[model samples]
Target: MSQEQRLEEQMLSQEAERRLSEQLDGAEKIDVDVQTDLLKIFQGQADGVSVTGQGLVMRGIRVQDIKLQTDSVAVNPLSAIFGQVELNHPINSTARIVLTETDINHALTSDFVRSKMQNFELNVEGEIVCLQPQEIQIHLLANGKIGFTGKVLLKEKGNARPVSFTAQVCPRTKHKPIMLENFNCTQGEGISLEVVVALMQKVKQLVNLPYFEFDDVVLRVKNMEVQKGTVTLLVDAHVRQIPASASNS
Candidate 1:
């Protein structure tokens, strides 16, 4: 058959193929993965949130940049290569980039994670991604709305970049649902600023990951101030840095 004919048939088809193929052939299982909770990731709007967080993690430069600047060092005196001390090819060292809120934002569950779409509940919508310099922040509100704001800081590894970003997960309802709280940025590098913006735009087009496929999970990881295997979010709670059995005297 001609390619044009195939195309025409596909376009003119009255009904899309009815389950062209079935997994497990014709067999079916009664067991299904029922979500026990709802996953939430607050995307607060520009003027709707009050942001607050600390203890930033380090997201250094890309390995590729360091790899390319290995011999591009400044050679002094007679050691200068070719007398003029030109930067050699294939230098490897550090990656200089404007680490903005967008970098951290992209590394968020929004762009940080690359998996199937998951479940998420949000109260507000943040502004489109942006970049400035040295400071990266997001506009937030008490209603859980947020707008990404801030500037680029670190430009390379060993850049002594003290970076961190966080927010409190205030669920709309009394009971907080399964949420990707303590949310942090993930691997960021390998693209130019323009590319990052464009990629972020693509992410906007794609379905938000945590909306459709994520199941609510409430596992308790050890909090720094809490004992191992302990999960507490109360005053004098270990996770909250308060002893469970001991109180300030």
Candidate 2:
């Protein structure tokens, strides 16, 4: 490649890395590599792109580490000249995402995730009950099982009480819902079996969602593996566009 072409390529790669870093809430490290040639650039195409990050937190969701590589990408040439990557077509990629036990627990308590678990209404024995989660923790166990312990505040008919429970979660395929193997009250009064089953069913529904969609990206997990202290997910990602930088937004 000519010196001018090499200089342009370097500039594009730098811009890509900068934009990617800006899209995250926080990260310990981030690297972006854009592969393209002058010919491909003029055609508004990239050979491929690879991204790797550690301690990435995006939209309040924490990820321990991630590696993603995309196929040929289509973008706008005009936008590329101005250091902006505007996609003209969606790009498909394979992603390997890793989360540690601590990452899982932190995400469980994060505002983004806790909002979905807190102050939910459940119908129990012909009575409307409100449930608020507190002190949730999860441990990645061996053999694809997760150990969970949590405290919850339950209100029924203006009466309130705290319940703490330990449970086992069995991870399954993407097509299937996670199974709640067992539940045992560790403190305070035991809850009704009916209420436990109802709560598990609600959790299963959330786990069985087809895909997770964000503003510019959609992800579907193809497989998951659980080992002691870590969980790894193989995922397919369809990205319509790179997320806009906070500064730009």
lDDT of 2 at 41: 80
What's the TM-score of each model vs. the native? 0.17, 0.84
The lowest-lDDT stretch of 10 consecutive residues in candidate 2 is: 199-208
Residue pairs in candidate 2 whose N, alpha carbon or C atoms collide under 3 angstroms: none
For model 2, the superposed segments whose C-alpha errors exceed 4 Å read 1-6, 59-61, 116-118, 125-127, 173-177, 187-190
lDDT of each residue in 1-249, candidate 2, tens digit only? 788778777878889888888877899988887788677787898988899999999767888989999999998988887776778999999999999998788778777787667487888878888878888888899878888888888787888889787888777656765676876767757567877766666555655576888778899888778999999988899999887767788
lDDT for each residue of candidate 1 in 26-145, tens digit (9 for 90 to 100):
211111111111110011101111111122222221111100011112222131211111122212222121223333344443322423223222111332333223333443343443
* Per-candidate clash tally: 36, 0
Superposition error at 69 for model 2 (Å): 1.2
Give the range of the ten consecutive residues with the poorest summed lDDT in model 1. Answer: 40-49
Per-residue error at 98 for model 1, in Å? 33
CA lDDT of each prediction against the hidden true structure: 0.24, 0.81
